[model samples]
Target: MEILSKEKNARNCKFKTRHGEIETPFFMPVATKASVKHLSSIELETIGTPAIISNSLVLYLRPGLEVIEKFKGLHNFMKFHNVIFTDSGGFQMLRPAFLIDYNEQGINFKSPFDGKKFNFTPEKSMEVQEKIGADVVMCLDNLPEYGQDYESVKDAVKLTHAWADRCIKAHKDKKQLLFGITQGSVFPALRKKSIEFFNKKEVDGLALGGLCIGESKKKMFDSIKLHAKYLRKDKVRYLMGVGSPPDIVNSVNEGIDIFDSVFPTQNARHGNLFTSKGKLHILRKEFFKDESPIDENCSCYVCKNYSRAYIQYQLKFKEGVGYKLATYHNIHYITNLMKEIRLNIKENNFKKFRKEFLSNWVTKE
Candidate 1:
């Protein structure tokens, strides 16, 4: 990876992973269960998605290792050629566990799919990701929800740092890159400590976890501003599980290089369309007679060939195609937004671009 340019706190960079090279600051569409809900890998590729994030937990539990090993790696299993990052399954800790416990041994939780119980140690996470085969593999980190006290946050950070060391020691795949996750909730002091600890580790990248998990936008951005500067500049900086338009713009300005979230695809499945001017509710009555595209400036196939009324009709009738089309358009919109962001950074006009975008992109309370 190389930083090509910088303007204020923002950076224009490029990363060459084992799978392929991608330009940063990029957005990764979430493929939680090895599929992006209503779309295929080919559809995602067609929409210009440079990469994607999938859950290692699902793959480990459902098909087991035998099925994936038959295909060698997730790329072969999913038939996706672009870059892929696998979550270490640490986020599962946030769920309501039928039986849960956390110790120095790691996370023990019941599988929601089956009644079987399993423990996911940092070593185990590394092993699963190695079998699942992603270009970038994440370390197992203790991620607590928002509003945790300082002591709890401090303990989470301690566990995260300990687990990161174990993951580093256990990861043996030379082709796969291991990334350490920083978890300190919104405590600036703890976050700074987490950053400093990982900066000295032998990990290939660093990811900001534990944000946007019910914290206010102000708190999240404040943490980003506080910790991003301390992150190793040469390593790829990923802000995990955040994909709102305004948040993406602000995070990029704070020097975050990669991001993944279910926002666009999930909202699109519910008849929401992300547009240049603002988010549009496709099911609204105002669009029933309107023949315009979702976004006049959108060049996605859905917008180019279909009218807003057509999509609304499909969505109103609950047609499967409606969800697919909407998902496609939303993914295209976000990826294109990333492209525009990179272009603006290259042109040294990122500040202007972000200000103008937010001014027009009205956010409803």
Candidate 2:
């Protein structure tokens, strides 16, 4: 709700939500099904996570609104007392029809849990988010997969813009922030058009969607840069579904203020760890006798008290400790990285840090 500081490269801001104030240039951990996989809300906060994202689609289908309303909202149900964002169910509708169905009216999908069919329209998505009571809610926009033909991409973009308008009209509360998603795939011009369309409407924030679905890293970065140039700097700009360390740094340099992805938690569940040097495969046999922590510089509890050998052995034997430790370390690495970026911005050295970090980080790739 307040602009703390504006850097040459980025805007450092503070957002006032019902839960609390969240600093800008923040990374929101993905809690797709109202949970961040292996981590709890308290644990997430302990690891320095300022915010979390939940999917409206998953919650709408599974427990349904009736169940969530019982708890009053997602905040009480999940017990996460921080800023929360709920994504429109548009992305999930892109799955196979057996899993989800899409139509002109909206998306119809069967509950993965009970085979019960459910419909999610733009208005319906807004209603669900209102019931969920997230601080920020995304509009239900049609998101197409990568490599679609130009005509299909054009149609999807048009539909998304229309849906955004409908969402804006349907939304009842001005206090709860709503964001318009820009969906143009890899086409820069379409992206620009989408940006202009939303810019006129003047939503609370703007999100760059439909990237990193299956595109190359170059294409993804290109799209981000192109869209970033067109977005309003005063309001927040969120780059969705992108959370790699390199990607995070690059997007920050491009002036992205918010981002959410499941990379760290998902990879940690699979025995992978991200570090300053690069990614590490902790499940490898080379760590069987290794004594060093996952990252010597990491100050997370896992890195402070455990060794790579210990984690590898635990994971090898399917112990829960390995997964929990790895998750903590990875989340810490990302949150710390963001902290360093924010500090650099305050010091006006973000460009220098970005260059130095990318040199070593990219070399490992």
Candidate 3:
């Protein structure tokens, strides 16, 4: 990791990977199925995306290891020749349908697609991800849900710690960076325990999991700050499952280096277009006749070439092209936002940038 510049707690760095170098304070769109829903690999490259995160277990179940191995790896299979990160599918534990039971051995999950049960041990997760060949691979973590009690969360923390060791031991790829995940739900003492455990291990990076699920924003940010303070600053800090203008800006200020979430693309599919001022509900009747771009401030291809009237018409009819355009704009906006964040940190004005941004960015409906 090369620390380029820092303003207060926020630092700009470069995380070198086997495929490429991912700049810190960057967001990765979730390509859980080896594809970002509405965009293609070519579009992702054009949007300035350096990295993407995919669900290892999902790919393992669907295309299977045979298909990916036949194509050489995920980069070749997906035609995305940039940096790629494969999530350990720990996030799947949040879904009641997928998670039947979890113990010290591993997790017992049922595939929602095939209705088949499978045992996913830490060693198995390491083996699968290594076969899938992502530049960055995460440890299989036990993520406690938002309202779970301390005892439950403590159990999760214990399991996560044990699994982290197993994952580390099983990981054999020297080129692929293995990141350990810290899960404590919303409990500070449990979070501290998890953090303290990973502090002793030599992982390429540390990910703050089990946040932004359903907890209050205050608690979420507090956890981020806690991770920022305790996790080794030399290695990269990744705050998983967080993506939004306000949350991202604040996370960056709190020293989060990398992020991945489906927020922008998911919200775009639902008609909420991110913009400089705020989110614009593009499907509203008011926009049906409006001739302006999605966001006047946004210089994305969608905004430059298309108008609100055109997009709304296509979206209203459920046209496939509409989804592509909306996803493109939202991703482009986020890409430019990260660029601005890196620039502000380099100029030592990130403090001012965060303040002004938070003051204007509101997510309430």
Strongest candidate by lDDT: 3
RMSD of 1: 1.3
Best of the two (2, 3) by lDDT: 3
Clashes per model (N, Cα, C within 3 A): 0, 2, 0
Tell me how candidate 3 scores on lDDT: 0.90
Tell me the lDDT of candidate 1: 0.89
- List clashing residue pairs in candidate 2: 1-14, 1-15
Query: Which 10-residue span in candidate 2 carries the lowest summed lDDT?
Result: 356-365
Instruction: Kindly list the per-residue Cα lDDT of model 2 for residues 1-365, writing each as its tens digit.
Output: 46676566576777777777778788988888889877888888898788889998888777778989999899899888888999986787667743466767787777666777877788988988998888899999988878898889999999898888889999987889999999889988899899889888858888999988899999998998887677776778899999988899888888888989988888887787898788888888788899999889898889889999999988778788878888888888998998888888877888888889987673221
Q: lDDT of all predictions, in order shown?
A: 0.89, 0.84, 0.90
Q: List the residue pairs that clash in candidate 3.
A: none
- Candidate 2 residues lying further than 4 Å off, grouped into runs, are 1-3, 97-101, 362-365
Please provide, for model 3 over 218-291, each residue's C-alpha lDDT reduced to its tens digit, 9 standing for 90 to 100. Answer: 99988998898888888889999899888899889899988899999999888888888878888898888898
lDDT of 2: 0.84
Candidate 1 residues 14-122, lDDT tens each? 8778877789999999987889989999999898899999999888998888899999989999989999999977777556763388888898888888879898888
